[model samples]
Target chain A: MMHQQFQDCIDACNACADACDNCAAACLQEGHASEMARCIALNMDCAQVCRLSAALMARGSQFAAALCRVCADICRACAEECGKHSMDHCQRCAEACRRCADACARMAAA
Target chain B: MMHQQFQDCIDACNACADACDNCAAACLQEGHASEMARCIALNMDCAQVCRLSAALMARGSQFAAALCRVCADICRACAEECGKHSMDHCQRCAEACRRCADACARMAAA
Candidate 1:
């Protein structure tokens, strides 16, 4: 089944999406929210792309790999941006995004 | 502010995404899943795009309108595809997709 075939990537993506969403929301609540704008934007992008990549992979869609490439790009950008922030949420999100980017890159190559 | 500006479209997108995900899962459980392949694919695509559109609009991203345009196109396709099915899930998904498509279109234009 598709789930079995892409379990690791799906799990990674799911985690990353959640992390991105949470980080974005937390960034909004930060005292220096204006400075977190780019991080928030990238987080939103990463979350959406990760969700889409996971869904496509779960269905064994041929376009999954292509989307994975896009997701990886977004995840990496999000991770880098989040890494610049000192907030706990941002730190955690950076880790998740890195993991997801790696997973997505592997999936895209697979 | 972003939420207030895109409230209706965002709500429609969220509802349609839930409906699409449910329809896809239901289709997979159906006895003739092969026959429902297109429906499932469209559902997944619509769900991801809607989620992405909602997130972008929520952030007041400059790209929100462009993504909403794509979301509207996908929603319209998904609605038409789901409308051909007689299953209750499909019917519900079709209605949700139509509403989302309209909402996204309005958001895109605005």
Candidate 2:
């Protein structure tokens, strides 16, 4: 069974990934695609890492601890970048990134 | 400028996330949704973590180094789990995960 902490981290990561993916797509559809290049890039990147970290922790992989540490940093940066835009997608992505970052940070420390 | 190594890690994470997201959708479309419960779960997780790690590294977040460590582990486990199924989607996700895991591992140590 997944530990409570691990589960929480996974939830955070999954939620963040979904948010990023949705936001990226929305950014692209908003016709400001050029301006959203960086945001889209960051969103895509953040979603991937969050998903991977959750999978690793779920399986109790040997590298889970280490991955959590890195995932946390990525989430934070993505949050900051997403936060830069006032678009709905960016705002949502930022929140998700922040939540995932915090959860991953706790997971890393654990 | 984004460091070559960091950029590489971000690429790996992005590729993996795309692979996982596509794979997950494929799994659902194939009507194997019930059987793919675990695989879908893992894919979603892997994609999120990979994305987050890439975003974190792109901007040189303070937590980048630590997050890299966790991202590596997550990628590895996701790869293994995805590799279990012989489906094309699983195969692709597995390959992406392995590449991401290796890239993240090197980045973490650096």
Candidate 2, residues B1-110: lDDT per residue as tens digits?
74555887898889999999998899889977998877777777677667777777886755666766766776787789889899988999999999999998888788
Q: Give candidate 1's TM-score.
A: 0.61
Runs of candidate 2 exceeding 4 Å displacement: B1-110
The count of backbone overlaps in candidate 1 is 0
The per-model DockQ list reads 0.28, 0.29
Interface RMSD of 2: 5.7
CA-based DockQ, model 2: 0.29
Write candidate 1's Cα lDDT for B1-110 as tens digits.
Answer: 53698989999999999999999999999799999999999888888878877878887766677678778888898999999999999999999999999999998898
Q: Tens digit of lDDT per residue, candidate 1, span A1-110?
A: 53697999999999999999999999998678899999988888888888878888888875677678767877888999999988999999999999999999999899
| Regions more than 4 Å wrong, model 1 | B1-34, B50-110
TM-scores for all predictions:
0.61, 0.56
| Tens digit of per-residue lDDT, candidate 2, span A1-110 | 54655888889899999999999899999999998887887777677667777877887755666776767777888899899999887898899899999988888787
- Whole-model lDDT, model 2: 0.81
- Tell me each candidate's RMSD, in Å, in order: 4.8, 7.7
